[model samples]
Target: MIVEHRIYTTHPGQVHEYLALYEAEGLAIQKRILGRMVGYYRSEIGGLNQVIHLWAYADLAERDQRRAALLADEGFRHYVRKITPLLAGQESRILVPAPFFTPTWQD
Candidate 1:
């Protein structure tokens, strides 16, 4: 499996606005298309105003297809428009687990 980890650094003091938007709108659209959410988190210490979320995919191909669908969704597009200005930076990484340690959760 592959894990996509996305970290969004919001404009200072805007984390709450981003979280509220995601919770009210983005989360449902994402859950409908990007089904394998590992977790969602917000930074409280070192990386203040950062939001981190993880999604697991069987492979890169599946990730691409699902992400494409998400991008096509009207609700997602609208949510993106509203949240774009609140972000300071965005980073994403695709992770491959080592043989000795793999995630136990099943999608």
Candidate 2:
């Protein structure tokens, strides 16, 4: 399995606004398409105004397909329009777990 780690740095004081927008508009659409959310988190320490989340996929191909579907959805596009102005930066990483570490939970 592969894990996609996403981090969004919101504009200075806009973390709450961003989170509210995501929870209200984006989460359901993403959950419907992505299907394997590992977790969602907000920064409380080192990086202020940061939102982080993880999603797991069987492989890069599956990830690409789902992401394409999500992007093509009208609801997701609307949500992106609403949230983009609040974001300062965005980063993503694809992670591979070690052979011994098994991920037992998803969604």
Candidate 3:
């Protein structure tokens, strides 16, 4: 499996607002479409105002398909409209687990 790491850096003091909006409006639709979420986090020390989340996919093709579906979702689009103004920057990365590593969590 491949993991997609996403980080959304919110406007200086907008982290709370962004998180609240995500929890209320974005989480459900995103979770339903993405399938596997490895982790979700907030930066409390070094990178204040940043939200980070990890999603797992079977492969790049699956990632592409699901991301495309998410973009087409009206609910996600609505959430995007609401969160766009709160964001300062965003980043995404793809990760592959090491040869000796194994996931412990049940899927």
Candidate 4:
């Protein structure tokens, strides 16, 4: 599996608005294209005003196809236009799990 970690720095005092918009609009549109969400987060440390989310894909090719489909979706495009101005900076990383890792179960 491939993992995507997206980190966003929101405008000062805009965390609440950003989360609300994401829940009400962004997430729904994302679900339509991406299908499953691994996790979403708001940082309580590391200088604040940060939002992070993780997504899992079957492979790099699958990730590319799904992400491109998402960007082409009209609803998602509209949300991007609305939310882009609220962002300070964004970063994304792709990760691979260790050989022994099991994402669905832990011990």
Clash count for each candidate, listed in order shown: 0, 0, 0, 0
In model 4, what lDDT does residue 25 have?
92
lDDT of 4 by residue, 1-107 (tens): 87899999999989899999999899988877886688899999876899998888888998899999998898888999989999998999998999998789221
The collision pairs in model 2 are none
Error of 3 at 29 (Å): 0.3
Model 3 regions more than 4 Å off: none
Misplaced by over 4 Å in model 2 are: none
- Tens-place lDDT per residue, model 2, 14-33, is 99999888999999999999
lDDT of 1 at 73: 93
lDDT, candidate 1, 65-89, per-residue tens:
9999999999899999999999999
| Per-residue error (Å), model 2, residue 32 | 0.1
TM-scores for every predicted model? 0.95, 0.97, 0.96, 0.93
CA lDDT of each prediction against the hidden true structure: 0.94, 0.95, 0.93, 0.88
Per-residue error (Å), model 1, residue 51: 0.2
Over all chains combined, what TM-score does candidate 1 have? 0.95
TM-score for candidate 3 = 0.96
For model 3, how does the per-residue alpha-carbon lDDT over 1-107 read when each residue is reduced to its tens digit? Answer: 89999999999989999999999999999999998988999998897889999999989999999999999999999889999999999999999999998887525
Find the candidate with the highest TM-score and give its number. Answer: 2
By summed lDDT, the worst window of 10 consecutive residues in model 3 runs over: 98-107
Clashes of 2: 0
